[model samples]
Target: MLAPTTVPMPGLPERVRIYEVGPRDGLQNEAAVVPVAVKAELVTRLVGAGLRTVEVTSFVRPDLVPQLADAEELWAGLARSPGVRYPVLVPNVRGLDRALAAGVEEIAVFGSATESFAQRNLGRSVEESLTMFAPVVATAREHGVPVRAYLSMCFGDPWEGEVPPERVADVAARLMALGCTELSLGDTIGVATAGHVQALLDALAEVGLGVERLAVHFHDTYGQALANTLAALQRGITTVDAAAGGLGGCPFARSASGNLATEDLVWFLHGLGIDTGVDLPALVATSTWLAAHLGRPSPSRAVRALAHQPSPS
Candidate 1:
């Protein structure tokens, strides 16, 4: 067992990468159809905030996720920032086709760590899902498009309580073997604790997986996202997935909340002297703008508190 103090907390990395998922994960669950221009502006502002890895949209069928039906139009409209990598979620071959047609160079595929959640989310078994993605990953490699695979419910599942660490590792290993360049472990329902996260990392290590290819995505439903993130960082994991204004929730999981707010994560990282390359004030401004457009108050505590402070003229 690793001692708490011995874990290398190393004062945040020199340059941490933040993958902004607001346009895709954040908006997909919303009932309202956010205008394509609004989505474009949001992505633009995120880029202005220094977020380089933004998930622009999902290429799923309109009948399934109607919110992202304008994937092509939205991707086409965005001003591509030089050096910024814009990736879209592709559920299958058809979605990959659409994303490629829209000129996307990177894509994400998803599967769940639990069987029941996998069945509910993808309507297929875990093995079947991997089989489905085998060709997708191969094709992506063929076209020189990198693939990021998301293993949802890695810590805990709503349908299946307390997912085993070994199960999460197995799924991650399979996805990595399938040619996924990165594997994002998602605490889909926000039920993970620091101890649980450490245990999961230990299990992954036991299977010879390094923290280099791993990223973490956590929800703050239980207010454990940041704490769990810190634990992952101590274990040497770098990349983090977050949404602006805390604007997302799992459509299949009841009462589930969004991924950790980007502003809050940036603030935490800054306080720890980690370099995320993001401008907190600009991020706050963008989060506030997006919250207003959604007709909802900002869910990010950092954004709300910063917005009320008078700026120096």
Candidate 2:
């Protein structure tokens, strides 16, 4: 059997990529509609805090996700930074077309590991949903725009409990074959444990899918996001997706909580002596600012802890 190759084993990269999804995933599920200007400012502030890749928004039907109704406007308001990426989520061909017209350089497509979640969230069977993304991916390839893939419900599904890791690996391999430059495995219901994470990574590796092409998106619903993230890091999976202020939940999965807070993830990364090129203080300030617009206190423990720290006089 191949030995476990986790972090600190010359496998983990010293520099990790934090794909900030706060602007898109976080806001898309918010109850209140976020103004385009505020959303644009949130992206700017997060980038100011050194987030190199921020998902600005998704291009779903406005009737379905009103929070991100201003996807085009938000994109228009953003000032592109050299060497920075702003990827928007595109579900199908139409969404991809909208993204391309907006001059998007990179975009992400989402699929589900389970059929039930796919039907609930994507309105189709898992197979059919992936089929829907084929043309979108092909079109993006023609335009020289890179595509990242997301597989939700990788761990457990509300309707189908205890999903097999092989199931996720199967979908991951297919997504990679479908022209996804990177694949993010998501614990949509937030029930993934540390053991579950390592097992899944091992299964993925068995299929010739290494950590090099993978990322993780975890929710703090059961308070296992950080622990699960540590397990992923130990496996040398460097790219982690997080939401600033921990501000998000699955509208399709109402029982699920928000994502792992970006501030919280950054705090964990910095404590491990890993470099994310992010300023914790600056990130916390951005969350605090956004929290006010949302009319709620920031949900990030790191942000709250830092908020109490005495500032330099």
Candidate 3:
């Protein structure tokens, strides 16, 4: 088997926790609905591949994202493994209710940095959307469930191009104030550059949200996800959000591409002599398996390169 030469990078974390979002974010944009059984199996395979945190499904309205309409059934069918964290996306109080009833251990709520995205994705203004999430976050806290808040378009917006870093920081501060435990900054359109990534992190830090409580979720639309991620890592970020096989794009934001692939991230981290606790070949095999189910070749460069390699005889 071939692998990147290990060259340690200075000032990088020794380990990174990859938050796998394939089953939810990846398949949610697919036009064809994936079976619940396949979804369950995909989650299991990702965990087996050594991904510690896997986001399984979302509790959003079924009509909105028909691909995830089987959230309850999928969660019920999963033969969850011990010591692996499975979080579900909950859009509103109603979504949170469904997740709690299904006994979800963790939940995430989606917010937007710009007013346009807030209106388009959540059907409300920025303030209105955060207002809606307050009680959801509060209720989840009351139930002892930790909530992760996703603030999309932290870099640029399709409708409102070039979001100000200060504005992103303000939205981030408010979301943190809503009793959320962690925050994932999303490059929804994949328009962020390395400098922009650093700037956003600095802005968040200025608002008292340090790198420890933050995660980076970059899309590869313009092929800058990896560079942006490196910038975040250099800034002391230890959590990254990626999808197996690069399987997801935002349904609401059509310009967005699939997320930063988990395999690719693992490859980069390993090359830098950083520990991810992921089995590279196993992660690639899992993506290859998922690509077959989706009837498309994976967009992940690492998966494509490694999945076709001849096994050592």
* Candidate closest to the true structure, highest TM-score: 3
Candidate 2 residues 52-126, lDDT tens each?
999999999999999888999889879878989999999899999999999999999989999999999999998
lDDT of 1 by residue, 118-211 (tens): 8988999999999999989999989999999999999888777889999999888888998999988899999999999989989988887888
lDDT comparison, 2 vs 3, better candidate: 3
Candidate 1: where are CA atoms >4 Å away?
A: 1-12
lDDT of each: 0.88, 0.89, 0.94
**Could you tally the backbone clashes for each prediction?**
0, 2, 0
Could you give candidate 3's per-residue lDDT for residues 1-313 as a string of tens digits? 5788999989999999999999999999999989888999999999999999999999999999999999999998899999999999999989999999999999999999999999999999999999999999999999999999999999999998899999999999999999999999999999999999999999999999999999999999999999999999999999999999998989999899889999899999999999998999999999999899889899999998998898768
Candidates ranked by lDDT: 3, 2, 1
* Candidate 3 pairs with clashing backbones: none
TM-score of each: 0.95, 0.95, 0.99
**Better lDDT candidate (1, 2):** 2
Model 1 superposed RMSD (Cα): 4.4
